[model samples]
Target: MVRPDKVEAVAEIAENFRGASASVVTEYRGLTMAQLTTLRRSLGDGATYRVAKNTLVKRAAEDAGVEGLDSMLVGPTAITFITGEPVDAAKALREFARTNQGLVIKGGFMEGRALSVDEVNRLADLESREVLLSKMAGAMKGTMAKAAGLFAAPASQVARLAQALADKRAEEGGAAPAAEAAPESDTDSAS
Candidate 1:
């Protein structure tokens, strides 16, 4: 005999779990309502923090095809459903936990993989997606510049060689006239 509201809540949680990119389970035993609100605000648009009954969460996880959350669901648990960037959400959770000792990060799941607290901390240490992309783009640009320089080297060397040959020809051409004039004067003297 499940209540209608509880059934609806389970449905919503299941939907969230299905849609989330990552989800962190935290034990918020000693956190006050105001502190919870502050933490939620800190998570920002990247994550949705919610408190659900362990039984409902279990049912929702099962419905959503997510496994290994049954043991973590015990105690006063709050789940942070991360839909945007997992790194950002992990950073927020880690920072909040540092200041507020009441929040204990149990574990999480990301991309169908379970994560321990140490794993979550590692995730937080990772740079954001945009930062990583920008670094990659910079590296690609540098590689392309080097490739262009390599490609142009032969053409530049050819041009320099042509200029050197032209200069040599000019020098020879000027000397020929002087040599002929000197010979003509010699011939006139000899005659």
Candidate 2:
């Protein structure tokens, strides 16, 4: 029989699962208290770094409608529940792992889909939301600028052609004979 406190813990984990945008399970076997603290601080407030029981976490994951997470809850597992930005959480964990050899990333889940370690690492390499949005905005601005240029190209060509024609006429001293007054009206009534 499970204790009431255990049930509450599971409930709390389940709630976190519901709110998390992504979660990564890692094996923190040889990490010191200070190292763990540093890692948690690096993850920032957007991510929750918790060392919960595997069985309770499995139960919470099941309750939260996320499947296939059981296989990743192996030895010395600690889960990072990402709230604000999944990419940020991934980046934090990746950076920590780079310096610390003991922290091994097992796997993760993003938007209810199971993700492999390689997939999580790829996510970590991604730029921030603002950078991506700015890139998109810059691309859109470039496209609009090109479209504006395309729209004005014909009018610019016409204006250039008119100027060239006027310049040639000015250089020639007058309009062409064909464009001059139709041979002055011949009135021979006096003759």
Q: Model 2 clash pairs?
A: none
Candidate 2 residue-pair clash tally: 0
Q: Provide the overall lDDT of each model, using Cα atoms, as 2-decimal numbers.
A: 0.95, 0.91
Please, what are the lDDT tens digits per residue for candidate 2 over residues 77-188? 8999999888988999999999999899999999769999999999999999989999999999999999999999999999999999989988775665544444432334
By lDDT, the best candidate is 1
lDDT of 1 by residue, 1-191 (tens): 87999999999999999999999999998999999999999999979999999999999999999998888988999999999999999999999999999999999998887888899999999999999999999999999999999999999999999999999999999999999999999999999
List all candidate RMSDs to the true structure: 1.7, 3.8
Instruction: Indicate the residue-level lDDT of 16 in model 2.
Output: 88
- Candidate 1 wrong stretches, greater than 4 Å: 180-191
- Provide the lDDT at 119 for model 2: 96
